[model samples]
Target: MNVADDDDPPPIVVPEVTVTAGGAVTEGAGAVFTVAAEPAPDAPLSVNVTVGQDGDFGASTGSRTVTVGTGGTATLTVATVDDDADERDGSLSVTVDSGDGYTVSSGHASATVNVADDDDPPPIVVPEVSVADASIVEGEMGALSPLEFRVALSEASEQDVTVRYVIRSGTATDGLDYWGGTGQVTIGAGRTSGLIGMNVKDDILWEGDETLTVELTDADGAVIADGRATGTIIDDDD
Candidate 1:
């Protein structure tokens, strides 16, 4: 198409080389940020990435250069500093400065680098001690058996532990429904389990079901995960 001197068919328009913004990083850590250009430039594209000194965390990395290859892309590393002190999180600005022959793409103009505090995580606390479950059978009207109430720990303790156990009142009575199944249960040193049993009474009652709930009373040395457990008595007389 031909045109007047003032309106000569507009010269062929070429897409200006463009670059986008970068990314964030943490304190005392290293992170790589990338900037991308549209069409490859005829020469190497050097982008000035300005990192304003916002705080101690982000000040570690100041003004840096990103060299875009003929392929139209480059990466810059942002190093952080972890000042092992209790401080609030900080941040810095990383902006793509307007260069010689490139345009800062929309939204690729700037980005933020967050500097997180370096604090040691709290120690993990778990249930170190626990108790074992117990089961017993009811004999005749008056019979005593090992209604073993076992006490245990997740791992063995360094020294012997004497945990007290008692036949706590439950759906079944202590004297009326069962016998002595309570007292100090001794766990030997470096042992995970300790046992204490009680005599369960079988009062030949055709009742439905009776329960003896055994519990640990003394937790002097170790912690208690499950301090209580129930023992069931089945009626045999039909």
Candidate 2:
């Protein structure tokens, strides 16, 4: 015959816990967190969980209790708050809290959820710059003629815009008919137009009316639209 031994039952072992995110999280969108246990818990386990966010993230539940069934895995939906304010990308964290029936893993106890900003940034726009043609009359005897050309922009800029102008010979000769050279014209901030000056030499010669070209290129803070303009030198000695 066998007698029953007077002894206590074996101690219950707790399951190790780990937290992981299901997918991506973004503003105006929600996400899920999976709490898993190793070895498939024999009985239901109650685990405490804490959620946190920072930067541009929205609101979320602070702390709650989750149940892990015998299947060893449980999931919870984490709600995200939405806002219209433009912001940068944020982060979300879910941590497994120490509880009675569960043990937190040293490496997998917490999980990070990257939250993306849904609000769009302002659009980038650059104004277009253009130049207009003008004519100057050659004065009799020895005199100087002022040929002023108009350079304009499509819209006013917050900063100064620099436009490069190069003189090209068309029907006129450089240094003989007019001051032909390359230079830059700067349109000041909040201004829409600027003037480019060219000096035409006056001489008592029978030279006919001639034309020259001014080309705009390499404009900073703006785009060149009407890049080329014609300058006419009216002959007064003819």
* Best-fitting candidate, scored by lDDT: 2
Q: Which stretches of candidate 2 lie over 4 Å from their true place?
A: 1-5, 23-30, 38-46, 52-61, 79-91, 113-124, 132-150, 156-162, 168-173, 183-213, 217-221, 228-238
After superposing all C-alphas onto the true structure, candidate 1 shows an RMSD in angstroms of 13.7
Model 1, 1-238: lDDT tens per residue? 9875776685543324343334555678765556777777667877777766466764545566778878877766667767666667777666787776677766667766666777766554332555666665667435665566666777776677778777776677878766765578667777888776777776657776777777777765677778878777665666
Q: Could you tally the backbone clashes for each prediction?
A: 2, 0
117-147 per-residue lDDT for model 2 (tens digits): 8888776678899999989889732588788
Using all chains and alpha carbons, the TM-scores for the candidates as numbered come to 0.43, 0.60
Worst 10 residues of 1 by lDDT: 12-21
In order, the Cα lDDT scores of the candidates are: 0.67, 0.86
